[model samples]
Target: MDIIQLLEVLKPAKDVVTVQIASQKDPLTPWFDLAKAVLPAAATAFVAWRAMNRSHRQFEITSTRQAAEFDKNLAQQTKALRVQTQIATEIEIKKEECRNVRDTCAQYLSLALESNRYKNDFDLASEYILKGNTQFIEKRNVAHENYLESSRKTLSARMLLMTYLNPETSPSFFESIKNVDTSLVSSAPNFGGVVGKCLAECRMYIEKKQAEISTIATE
Candidate 1:
């Protein structure tokens, strides 16, 4: 080939290189920089959205747990209130039972007091047996002793009536008051006698049962 033909071919190849360099460096550079900025902003927005979504889910879970806890506490409190109401009702019933027993004991005491009317008569007649005098008074003393003995017998008989009401006293009794059940003797028993003790102990036992019931219910 001639030199002109070779020069022409070389010149065209150099123009293609300049055009490629201009394409790589000039027109797309601004677009690539804009893409870099937009991509980072989009990544930051997506990360923020995900963090907010996670936090919202955590809040929903926390709210559900709190609601469940509230329901459980409310149920326990209601159960305790119901048990307390039941115990209060039972206590009132037991107290009413104690009142009934007390009334029964009062009736028996009234009857015993009414039947002890012979005490005044025996008090006056017994002085004659302890005095000394002439033959006339001595004869009167024998009459007085007989009268006293009759009065004593009458008093003993009156007290024996308690056995009729209470079959527990069907056994022997001592006129000296040492062998009879204390219910027959008004001079010794504390509240009233065995009858009174029976009532009091029964009420006490019921009260003890009430305390036990309260403890068990709370547990």
Candidate 2:
């Protein structure tokens, strides 16, 4: 039963005892009996109150612990988000750097290919000059050998004259011609014009290759 109902029942019983004592001749016996009965009831009510108080304290402690755990979890999640953001920023920076490096390498490779083409043309011209020189040295027909030697000499002279006249020209062309002897062009017919045409073709080839390389570099 509720505390109020139990108290009501106890009150009527106490009132009946009081009435009985008033009617009796012994007053000490009634007082002693009332004290003994009321003391035990008060003790039981105090125990019940203590048990409720302990349960309320335990609930408060449990709620505080749960709130602390939630805060700890939230803090950990925030730290992880910060770490992930930093990592993503670093990765983006590295990707940009890699793109720049790749572009630079592509430009360099394009230039290198043009340079290789020029070198190949230079090597071919040098080979032709060497072959002409060897044919001139072999004296099969004196006039034909003289003509071949004259052609070789004209090639050498044109290369030298271009170098002397256009000193600021590309060293790649000048270097290719510098090793040849220029004394064999004694009286060869139209050899100078032929050599000039060959040099012009070489210049045109280099210019074309350079233009192509420039386009690639820009891209």
Candidate 3:
């Protein structure tokens, strides 16, 4: 009951203590502690990275939209400026055309007046031919040539005016000019009145055309 009994009781308590020490010093214990310390920090870092990436994407999308809008506005402004320039250029061309037409009309009236001056000489020359006067033949020929040349110049100037004006729009003006030309031969009592009427009509038409050009420019 003395030494053997004491050894058996001591051996049971020693075995329990040895088992507890072996469990505490297990090979996987250090790995488990390291995982506990690092896992939460790694998870937080991943979440922050994902949030930053989403924010970057949103910023890029906003920037792209703004750039597209700016380009669209710029294109519209450029188109408007181009249209204005075209309108200005067209108005200048129309004004030049009006000036040419007015000049041609003046030339036509001048030629018609010159032709009227020759009408009396032509009538006299015809009388001499009827009377069979050979000495007056050369004088009659010269008067006839002058009349024909004046008439040709008047017609040419009228044709040049027609190139710039639409006949359908200014029928009265053209008709008045025609009446003046006819009066050159007939030597009508209303010759001066017809010339005056022609000038009035021409001036009216020119004013109308200029007004239209002004309207276009304002628009």
Candidate 4:
């Protein structure tokens, strides 16, 4: 109604308008909101990248350890294989040597038998000479020469066996061979039993060496 009353009502309205203006958003409010939203996502992405890197490093370490273990196992297998091969080779060589010895011993026995046959012929011719048969003198000389040659060959074969025989490893075989040698050279020689025993011992020795070779191959 009057100017003073209208001024009081208008003052209240002006104060309300001032408060609303002060509370209103600034011009940079949208940019601040965008930063807030982007910061959380960027932090999450950084954390994920770190986790992936750590996993990759762990994988690398595991792969390296596995590779090293594989190499060690392979080296050990190769060494074992090499050792087996070496042992097998040695066994084969020894087997061959045993065969040689067996063959040579048989040859010696054959020569000894031939020498005994020639000795009989020489003795028969000597008996004729003692009975005053002049024609038997040349035959006796020839038989004597043949007997000496056969004996020499037998001795040579026996010497060859001495090089191959091992008394320590093949004691029974060595003893059997000794008995055969003595029997063949003795005045009243017994050939049948001693010859059989020597050959049997040779067979057993060869069989034992063969078994060793088989074991090495399997391993």
Candidate 5:
């Protein structure tokens, strides 16, 4: 071939090579720019997702702690209420016991007064018997002696009543005496009816008071 013909063929080949290189470089330039632009956005999205997940976990933990605290407070309040109820029940029981003691004392006092009256009657009966048998001066002496004995018995009964009913004094000894005297008076023949009635009434009062105490104690 001639030089000009060879030159024309080489020129077309060189131009084709240049056009391919430029096309590849054009696509690569845009791809590098896109990667550079998206890198920061992708990193930011990752960081935001991690932060949101951490916040969610923190909130869950806080909620759990709050729930636990609430349960503890509820338990404490329930315990307090139970303690208060127990204390109140004890107070009521003590109050009932005091009332029972008072009523029992009153009953004993009533019995003592009744016994004094009966003793007075017995003294008068004795005087009548003695005076009916005696001459004039003897009858007067017997009546006077009987009156003195009756007065003495009445005073004794008064003193005994005071000992039982006084709040300043302890009623323990009187309580023991109450059962013994009630039994003794009940067994007596002539005075049994009057004494038995008084004993029965006193017993009834005691039983009622005991029932009240039991009811309070149960609470």
Candidate 6:
């Protein structure tokens, strides 16, 4: 038979049958199935890890900030303490100077009295008076700057001049500085009523400074 006639003869008897495919897909391949099963869990684990890492970083930052603040506070306290200590040391030094000045001034007063005893030798009296005055001025400077400069305890030049001539002769010195006459009160250098009174004031000043220093230390 001819090829066209043979093809025509191979056709179905009644009609050609048609096949229809369903909408849904079949099961996936092995690798795709494994990904489908594990991807969600892996994604969840990744997200949780990221959250934990973020929290850890935040904690580290907070701890670092707290540590820095603590250091700053400690440094401030240390500086304040050092300043208080320096102030206390300075006050103590001033107290010592005050004591020295008091002793030296008492000695100068006694020396002046001794100089006045030489009534016959004018040159000797003048020499001793000049020496005592110079020594007293030198010793009184520091205490005067601190205590007497603002008060009536300061010695005037005129008063010092009279005191240089005679230790207990100056009315201003006797009235303002020391009340009683040293010779009449006592012959000893530091035992006179005036010396005692001045020393009391010095002690009072020292005590006041000590109280202030203590207050600073405590605060």
Query: Whose TM-score is greatest here?
Result: 3
**Cα lDDT, all candidates:** 0.53, 0.51, 0.83, 0.82, 0.59, 0.53
RMSD (Å) of each candidate, 1 decimal:
12.6, 20.2, 6.9, 7.4, 11.7, 13.6
Relative to the unseen true structure, what is the C-alpha lDDT of residue 148 in candidate 6, on a scale of 0 to 100? Answer: 31
Top candidate on lDDT is: 3
Best-first order by lDDT = 3, 4, 5, 6, 1, 2
Clashing pairs in 6: none
Candidate 2 vs 5: which has more TM-score: 5
* Residue pairs whose backbone atoms clash in candidate 1: none
Residue pairs with colliding backbones in model 2 are none
Give model 2's TM-score versus the native structure. Answer: 0.32
lDDT of 1 at 163: 34
Tens digits of per-residue lDDT, candidate 2, 72-148, equal 99999999888767666655554554444334323323333333333344444556557785553334344354445
lDDT for each residue of candidate 4 in 1-219, tens digit (9 for 90 to 100): 976567668786555433234677798999999999998999999999999999999999999999999999999999988897898788788778868977987897788778767777888899999999979999999998998999899889878887887799889988987787677666234576777788788789778877877776676
Backbone clashes under 3 angstroms, per model: 0, 0, 0, 0, 0, 0
Residue-level lDDT for 126 in candidate 1: 49
Question: Of 4 and 6, which scores higher on TM-score?
Answer: 4
Q: Which ten-residue region of model 6 has the weakest summed lDDT?
A: 149-158
lDDT of 6 by residue, 95-143 (tens): 6655554555555445434333322233334455577755544334443
Which of 4 and 6 is the better model by lDDT?
4
Give candidate 6 misplaced runs (Cα > 4 Å).
Answer: 1-27, 36-41, 44-48, 118-219
Residue 44, model 6, lDDT: 97
Worst ten in a row by lDDT for model 5: 15-24
Give candidate 3 misplaced runs (Cα > 4 Å). Answer: 1-52, 124-136
Stretches > 4 Å off in candidate 1: 1-31, 107-219
State model 2's lDDT. 0.51
